[model samples]
Target: MATAFYSHPDCLLHEMGPGHPECPERLAAIEDQLIASRIAEAIERESAPLADLADIARVHTRAHIDFIERSAPSEGRAWIDPDTSMNPHTWRAALRAAGAAVAATDAVIDGRYENAFCSVRPPGHHAEPARAMGFCFFNNVAIAARHALEVRGLARVAIVDFDVHHGNGTEAAFAGDERVLMCSFFQHPFYPFSGADNQAPNMVNLPMSARTPGTAVREAIDLVWLPRLEAFKPEMIFISAGFDAHREDDLGNMGLVENDYSWITEQVRRVAERHARGRIVSCLEGGYNLSALGRSVVAHLRALAEI
Candidate 1:
């Protein structure tokens, strides 16, 4: 089956600021690389729909949703946190970003596609149940996981987050829930510094030091994440595909390259094949340096598509 590619033009309109690193150009960069690499034509492309409020409520509080809706500005940007903001287009863009995950889940579950890649933003995995942070408004992966469990009757689902920063929001959503297992690694002593401690049994969070190399990351996955994931035997797998760990990204200090992204994707694909019947849904989270992000995403898609 072909892999599904989900994106929306609204995603490109949710800009943070003039010189923000998490700009709309990120999507264009990926598209350019996809075209240049001749990978765009191989996958099935689809426009993302707006996520339903009912689905959003599954993972976030109604009050949180109401607050974000109320915070949407008519012309200028509204600051939720010092680092996070919402423009006139941000609210709709956020909905589409989360919606892409839900649509991807449906496609994979229905066997319309083997797997899917959602190239939407502002990056999630940082937005908590009641709070938004780290350039995220909604926890897209968390929402998708809940959709698979509650709506699709999936008993077991796994979320794999490889962002350079910890997916604190995702961990918060599924930490105590037995239905989901979240495995991830991040640069410790970094932003939203909370994953190294207070981890629940269902969460496999590995915190690496600054400037850690790809070899160490591979070892952590081999010795830690893989064993736990295999035992979990999830019915579906969701990936928080972040590429900021690339060495060229100024936002993160990890020494990962495109090869690291490809290698890790292969490892995750093996786990999915073994336990989840190759069902996977991946969403964009973080990857700042445009060139590195584009190159890294190509490598990741190559692995996911097995091309």
Candidate 2:
């Protein structure tokens, strides 16, 4: 069984600005590292398709979908927030990003691949049911989880978000939904601060302080996330694989390293193997430092591919 790597050229066309951290180079960095690290040929690469409005609507409101479509600028940038913006290609790029997740989910479920990784841009996990923020326009992982449940009739799924910021949008989409379980850790008192205050039984959101090290994050995952995931016994696993928590990434103040990400992927893979028949769909989220992002993603892929 091989890992499916999903990406598209449209993802490169959607840029916030000239020097924004979440630039198209982020994907290029990943590609460069994949080739440099010899992981490119180990996985199967697939171009992402445009996500259908119905699939996106499984997690986002129709009004929100309409707004995103209407928000595309013809020739200039349109600001969604202070840190987020859109160009003419943003709408299609966002759809492809979400579509990669959905398609990856189906591939994993159908056993076409052992697991998958979606390396698309306009990284999701921040776009709420009706609001877009934090450099995201749609909740990609959330939509994929919904597809696994609503379309595939899976009874349970687990969402693992390791981004530096809280997945407030994903939480908004499935906070009280018992069919889904979301586990995450993020920098506290940071951008889009909300996970620490959440008390949902199905959500295991750990808010670590700014400078928290990887050891602490690992402890929390081992003691908290793994136990809950084991108990829930999800039929499939979805990972919002963000690398901004890397110590070198200036986007946030966390102390995780490439080895930490590899370890985290291994842990997640173990759980997936145990409960989900090794069905995992991981999507790229945040990691601004190009070098660190590239290295971290390669490490993650190595772990997922067991290479």
Candidate 3:
């Protein structure tokens, strides 16, 4: 089955500001690389639908959803946090970004596609149940996981986050939930410093030091993530695909490259094949350096598409 690619034009309309790292151009950069690599033609494309308020409410508080809706600006940008802001189109963009994850989950679970990649943004993984931070308005992966459990009747699911920073919101959402197992590695002493401690039994969070290389990531996956994931035997797998850890990205200090992204994706794919029947849904989270992000996404898609 072909990999489903989920995105929306509104994702390109949610601009943070001038010179912001998490700008709308990031989606275009990935598309440009997809076309250049000849990968776009091989995949199935679909427009992301708006996520229902009930779907958003699964992982976030109703008050939080209402706050985001009410917070939409009429003329200019509204700053939610110091690093995150919203333009006029941000509300719809955030919905589509989250909706892409839900749609991808349905496609993969229903066997319409074996796997899916959500290329929408206002990247999630930073937004918590009641708060939005790090340019994230909603926890996209968390909502997808919940949908798989509640709506699709999935008993087990796994989330793998390889961002340069920790998926604190994801961790928070499934902290005590045994149905979901989350494994990840992130640069410690970085932004939103929290994942190093207070880890639950179901969460395998490894805190890598600054300037850590891809070797450590591979070791963590081999020694830590894979073992736990294999034991979990998840029915579906979710990925918080973040490429900012690439060595060229100035957003964070890490030594990952395109090859590293491909390698990690292959490892995840192997896990999905083993126990999940090759069901995987990956959502874009973070990646700043435009060239590195584009190249890394191509590598990731190549692994997901097995092409």
Model 1 residue 103 lDDT score: 96
> How many clashing residue pairs appear in each of the predictions shown?
0, 0, 0
Every candidate's CA RMSD: 0.6, 0.7, 0.6
Relative to the true structure, candidate 3 reaches a TM of 0.99
As a whole number from 0 to 100, the lDDT of residue 243 in candidate 3 is: 96
After the best TM-score superposition of candidate 3, give how far the Cα of residue 34 lies from its true spot, in angstroms.
Answer: 0.5
How do the residues 1-307 of candidate 1 rate in per-residue lDDT, one tens digit apiece?
9999999999999988988988999999999999999988899999999999999999999999999999999999999998999999999999999999999999999999999999999888999999999999899999999999999999999999999999999998889999999999999999989899978999999999999999999999999999999899999999999999999999999999999999999998998998888999999999999999999999999999999
lDDT of 2 by residue, 28-90 (tens): 999999989987889999989999999999988999999989989999999989999999999
lDDT of 3 by residue, 1-307 (tens): 9998999999999998899999988999999999999989989999999999899999999999999999999979999999999999999999999899999999898899999999999888999999999999999999999999999999999999999999999998999899999999999999889899878999999999989999888988899899999999999999999999999999899999999999999999999999999999999999999999999999999999999
The CA lDDT of each predicted structure is 0.95, 0.95, 0.94
Q: What is the lDDT of residue 109 in candidate 2?
A: 92
